[model samples]
Target: MKVKGHCLCEKVEFSISVESKRFDACHCSMCLRWGGGPALTVEAENGVDFADEAFVKVYSSSQWAERGFCSHCGTHLFYRLKEGNFWNVPLGVLEDRNSFEFSTQIFVDHKLGNYDFANKTKMMTEEDVLKAFGAET
Candidate 1:
């Protein structure tokens, strides 16, 4: 399916093709802080192609992850890692909200104390997450 996404201000938009079942939610600390919870991330092998550079700003969140957002509105765009070329796009940013479904949950160990996952989404550790994407960190 062709997944379409845009920033909150609509200044930045993008399109990518991905399998529905490949979508995942990440509960890592940086992801949680970035999205205020689990970051609904989908791997785009082709990476994100920005509609405009005026709105997109990148933040080096860590040695492993760098976050991108709208410079005008601060809308989180994508989270990137050096080890993986795939851009992790947030599901909430998609124009077609129902275009994807949660396939798995990563970093369950780092998830918040009050929240718990009820669905059948597979939970994995930091190692599993990094290994899945071939990331060392």
Candidate 2:
């Protein structure tokens, strides 16, 4: 499905191609520090189309992935893998939020004691995530 959304200030708008409404919450340390909580995201294939790309600032968060946000309002946008043209876009930023489900939780071992979700999701530990992506565990 194709979804459209904008940043907090609306200075940055985008349209991305996604597979389903089901999203995942990442509890990795990098994700927690980036958004002050779990990064709820939906997988988007290929890439995203930004209205004005200048407003989107990207940070190389890891060797294989990077994060993008609105430079103006600092709204967390997407976490993109450098290879395979894959993107994990924040669900909160998507315009049509209906019918979305919390499906998985990645890096479950890195989750802190401060918060958690009640829904029973398919939790994957750091090792599982790394192995699934063919990365070094």
Candidate 3:
């Protein structure tokens, strides 16, 4: 399915194709510190078309991943891998966030102990995630 979305100020608009409405909550430390909460993202590894590309800033958060945001509104947009052209867009920035269903929680070992979600999601610990990504453990 194709979905359209934009940043808070609407300065950065994009349309991406999604295979499913399943999204994941990343509970890694980097994710928590990035937005003060788990990053809820849906994979959109291909066909991401941006309208105002100039308004989007890409920050290399890690050796393997880069994070994109709207320079105008500071709205976190996407997490992209340097290799494989992999992308995980933040669900909150999508126009149809309500359609997505919770499917997984990555970095479960690092999730904040202060709160828990009511939804039952497949949990992946840090080691599991690292192994899956072939990232350093």
Predicted candidate 1 versus true structure: per-residue lDDT over 21-61, tens digit per residue: 36788888888777788888787767887767788889999
Please report the candidate that would top TM-score against the real structure.
3
Report the alpha-carbon TM-score of model 1 versus the true structure: 0.88
Ranking of all candidate structures by their TM-score, best first:
3, 2, 1
User: For residues 45-122, could you state the per-residue lDDT of candidate 2 as single tens digits?
Assistant: 768888889889999999888999999999988899888888888999999866689899999999998778999999
Q: What is candidate 3's lDDT per residue for 13-122, written digit by digit as tens? A: 99988999989999998999999899999999594699779999999998888999999899998998888878999999899999999999998888889999999999
Pairs clashing in candidate 1? none
Residue pairs in clash, model 2: none
lDDT accuracy of residue 77 in candidate 2: 87
Best by lDDT: 3
Candidate 3 Cα outliers beyond 4 Å, as residue runs: none
Worst 10 residues of 1 by lDDT: 15-24
Query: TM-score per candidate, in order?
Result: 0.88, 0.94, 0.95
lDDT of 3 at 3: 91
